[model samples]
Target: MNARLLILLPASLITAPALAQGGDSPLDPLFTCRDIADDGARLACLDAAVDALRSETESGEVVAVDREQIEAAEEATYGLTIPQFRLPGLSLPGGGEDAELAELESASASPQRVIVRDTNGQIESIEGLAVAEISENRSGDTIVRLANGQVWRQTDDTYVQLTRSRADTDYTATISNGALGSHFMRLDNGGRRFRVERVE
Candidate 1:
């Protein structure tokens, strides 16, 4: 899969002149709040900062997600070569640090039918071994830690009870996108499917 830059920084920060309390730029909120000696005043300053942050989010000037949402989204998108909003870098697949560097066979090919290959040759898919370690939270969500150092947590309310299939079983995580641009990761042979979000 090809990586695309999906930046969501506030456009005002990028294009507007520095904000000012007067003609000169005002102190940055984080920096200014740190200098407040009075506890109440410091808290009020911090509140203002939080209000600014919320306004940025509400105005669609910044892309923001809570920790829970992010954790869910991450688990669902593991193994997919997702676009990042950070720096300019190589287009890489979504996986843990132990992920193998695989290349897309053809960049000009069709979208969903992406073919990935390692140094050896073409690969079936991004593969991971289901380790003995697993857990289910009170919310009915699950987290699966693979042997390859990748941790996949089940997002949403979907529940997939695991089976002791094998002592050392390898699982396939296939990423497929819908026409509406939604992506789904399916664990092949794992009885149930989850709206998983990759957190690792």
Candidate 2:
């Protein structure tokens, strides 16, 4: 953005001069573009004068009169208060989805663990369990290991044992739990041996 263009846009938009009442020029109207060398030169001079006036108007030395405030003050002086014109509520036509999402994410609480029952009628104890490592296998199966040397794999509603040994030594094994909630042991049984269940 050009600096001159920015100044020009604001200057042109301002219908009434801030300091001068009724948009009156400080210089007399008689001393216009016609008084210059030629039409083009005269126009240029007029533009320069306008720019100078705008600059002067912007300076803090001049006290700019706000017409609205002036009128309100006058009304109060006369003991007749006029209701000021108010702009209606401004709203974006379309909803701000991104902004709303950002606000929701900011205000949202972090993930929390609630005590839930397991498939084997056992209360899945997550007490003092700080998640150490979480991984997903090639079969889209999620495995969770806690800080308390407890390893759990997503079996069904319950997290079943991926391995019996939880001595902090990582060992991969094949374990099975049926849809009937039956626990079985299968070593090197491949993927088909274990009956997979939804781990909601």
- The best candidate in terms of TM-score: 1
**Global local distance difference test of model 1:** 0.44
TM-scores of all predicted structures: 0.33, 0.22
Q: Give the alpha carbon lDDT tens digit for every residue of 91-145 in model 2.
A: 2122223332232222112123232336643332212223445566776666644
List the pairs of residues colliding in candidate 1. 74-197, 74-198, 75-196, 75-197, 75-198, 75-199, 76-196, 76-197, 76-198
- lDDT of candidate 2? 0.35
lDDT of each: 0.44, 0.35
In candidate 2, how many Å is residue 17 off? Answer: 19
Clashes of 1: 9
Tens-digit lDDT string for candidate 1 (1-200): 65443333442332112111113222267578989999999999998987886786566555432333222223323344452211112221332222222112111221233334346432333433334356776776777655444556675666565557743234444543323334344555666556655555
Which residue runs of candidate 2 sit more than 4 Å off their true CA positions?
A: 1-31, 34-37, 62-67, 77-200
88, model 2: CA deviation in Å?
Answer: 20
* C-alpha root-mean-square deviation, each candidate: 16.8, 26.1
